[model samples]
Target: MRTFFITALASILTFPVIAGTMDIRVLSDINLSSLIVSPISGQYAIMADGQPVSDSAKANIFQLILEGDSIVMKTLEKKIGKFAKVIFTGVGKNNIIKIKSVVPAGRIRSYDDHLEVSVYAAYMKVINKVDLERYIAGVVEGEAGGVTTNEYYKLQSILCRTYALSNVRRHELEGHQLCDLVHCQYYRGRTTDADIISSTAATKGMVIVDGSLNLITAAFHSNCGGQTVNCEDVWAIPLSYLRSIKDTFCIRQPHAKWKRNISTEDWMSYLALKHKYPVEDSLSFNNAVSFGQAGRAVYFKDKDIKIPLKTIRGDFQLKSTYFSIEQRTDSVLFRGRGYGHGVGLCQEGAMNMTKLGYSFKDILVYYYKGVHLVDLASLEFFREE
Candidate 1:
């Protein structure tokens, strides 16, 4: 895909951008969802994470996708993910939305502060903000899907804020690591992509975690013995994120396409011995769960099978929590499922919530502990001189 980026801001860095409020236009090719409700981002008059997005903040790129129902956003880096939303409340003409029955400025936040935006561009050039916005408006002038030109203008405002929020999260809170680095987030494409941004914007500011919101850190895995894992064994964060097994709908386990008729025992042997683990004729996959069923400290070829409490507790954001040593038909089977160091906010789990009657808010409160919705309009009171 070919895209052009216009952001001069660093992808990672603390707020209070070093420069004095530099602005630019963004260009992308994604049919964005309604940005008016994106929970994770707030315009300069608002904030990310549902708070008031600081005025000083700016997007890594303000895009002007001069194209169709979709535009491609390009960047100079590879990223894991990004959060975005489309704003609906027009600049005027009775722009209002209700949250818990209170009508505030036309702003919204995504649930659980969970908005991710990523662009797949190894290298690109920058453009001007003014020209970019104009270009974007022109393309969406008379398009399909019933999105009016006014709505397109509102999108320009919304994405500007959404992209800025992602810049801060990925670069600052995350230490400026490129998401595509694998170990980092992972870059699929621009938030403006039809499939990526549009779907996301549709449910803008849809809450993922809420209620007590107390450092809520629930956890989940790729697969659960057809059952959810016990909270203690899987939790690395606090009660803020300790929920039961959740269906992420992201299932398509590896090797699903391979036509293998090997016996279960053969599969274990291939997995263990091939991975370099010494395999004895008596080794088994059932042992993977021995620690749970048995107590005397299980071992594999003399290695203690029990793991430390700290190793599996409180904020290990880079690994899966579903792990075990089971007795396969042959060699012992050591297996794990899921992603994200098993701390909090499973992306797949949240997707499952979307299927259920639970709106984003329900999902957030179910996973996290305590929190409440605060009006971002209050931000008007905190402008920096």
Candidate 2:
């Protein structure tokens, strides 16, 4: 009997825990007068202030309205009011809730698990408490979309998981752990793509961590032209794993090349106004304006008046800092490459590598240097009690 018990324990420890949930605040920063919530699938119960208002509720739809700092819930024209909070919980596996804002026409979204709503002043604050794996599926679609290959989806799944685990406590003060915004991770409810769903499930609870067991930022961009940039160059915080690398895969991608023409006078005026650059001094000004980028330059010029390329990118609303300046007749042509902050993984490059039959782990290693793919379920904190 003792040998049997020991064997069972060993078997259980070998497998990872598959059940973990997360509290994601959706539409957190939006203020709406009323919202419509309906159960798309399965049975759901509506609770008011911790008390069950109706068990096995028959009504398929409900509306929540804000009335003078109080929340009022109405279903079938029957109104219930003065509740501090309301919870909509699914009774079975197929139960899914559809939430839409009544004030904003056609603003509808769906969730797979449960929803917690409360009234603050004249608006409704909603939080979606859902299984972590399910949330990751939505995040994968939200970040990468449905067009990429399964391996690319797997790579994105790991990145999304790592990002979620790393910044899980970002919105603790606001109530939930994370919000459904780019400020957090763009989570647009559930995903319908089979590949996204399968990939997310395949890489369940997998996250990228550095040598010290800390979760890396897992930053990604649309394209990197011909190279990826270090984190320090973009955000000023140097991370060892986020090293710059040459990437030829994304060179011909859609976001690889860009051009913007600015009048030479307007360009000089911006430099003069913003950086107090000596535009009148032909020697220094000419050196700064007529520069070419053989590679990514930290500064627009090598002179002492060092203007950060990032600042220039921000000021001019440029695609990237990797650009060269060409003096035309009346306008200064700015030829740029890449899109977004080239900090970590390049999505186009990753997609190409996946097309070339590279595994998700191989793609990750190519982008993020010295990172380990660790399973969240195997971690102590993620294990079931």
Candidate 3:
């Protein structure tokens, strides 16, 4: 956990770096009892409780299942001995493996480097120990997938890397650095996208930092609906780098606008029961149905009654808090703008900027205010100085 300081004139900065790895909990949300692991490339040393048993080439494919508090291993035609832990140590370069869950019948996925399998609580827990760059590529592919330019991919790569390193110890108590979920970053193992891999390499060890040399939140979303909101408006914390700004790049992109309908009864009942709004009053009822958000508003209409737009968005399952309400026959029509929390970088806007010939640095600075791109190694130099 290091921070880098930079001069005000510089927008992009760099320093040396040491290659590292991250342990990510794979299929973290699934309650898996059994899974099949097969080697796809390179070699893997199969170890049962730290003792080498066989190589991946000899085993070809192996099945792991949970039995009581231990893990049972099996091959195609024979059953291997049960062990408390099973580890697949990736040897040499180009190590890759395919994993498919058998208990709940989940889809197959390919991963790079090593894997650690053990029994946790009532189910089997699998962790993918992958290189840092490889993990960032997988995260970028999962978070932003579409026809994208190299600059856009590079922008996303730096953001993903910064986000990853910032929260590296999020699940340290659980025996992993991060999880393959949106809670950390959406990572689905090794990515096959050539552009994504190249972009990640191009921006290796790059991260965004505030003026105080601390890593920014690096938050991003699908679209901003023409403008982004300040961090305090969303999370109630004033982040200097996460200021609101007008972004016209994603004005016409997909997910920028959405419409949802909620019955008047349901809406009134929720407001009346949960928020204790004066639903019976004629003025409040009219204001509730006719609420409009020409721009982002922290709370619903009326100064005294502070109904957070975020709460309304969550209760109604709306796409975003930037929405306008209208009364129809028996329902309230919510015309929503944007597709996420509307903070920090806008993925579609950055992609559009790349199409307009803007470099990755240009897009990064445009979204994140008063931030500098620095390398991890610079922290030590700045501290020593």
Cα lDDT, model 2, residue 112: 89
Candidate 3 regions off by >4 Å?
1-19, 55-57, 380-385
Model 3 C-alpha lDDT per residue in residues 40-97, reported as the tens digit of each score:
8988888998787754456788999888988888898778888999998889689999
RMSD of 3: 3.7
Candidate 3: lDDT over CA atoms? 0.86
- lDDT string for model 1 (239-329, tens) is 4344444434334433111111234565445435544433353443433224232221112222534334234322223233344444435
Taking all chains together, each candidate's TM-score versus the true structure is: 0.36, 0.92, 0.92
lDDT of 2: 0.83
Poorest 10 consecutive residues by lDDT, candidate 1? 1-10
Q: Show model 1 residue runs off by greater than 4 Å.
A: 1-184, 188-196, 202-289, 293-306, 309-319, 328-330, 335-340, 373-385
Candidate 2: where are CA atoms >4 Å away? 1-19, 381-385
Error of 1 at 169 (Å): 7.2
Q: 6 in model 1: Cα distance from truth in Å? A: 36
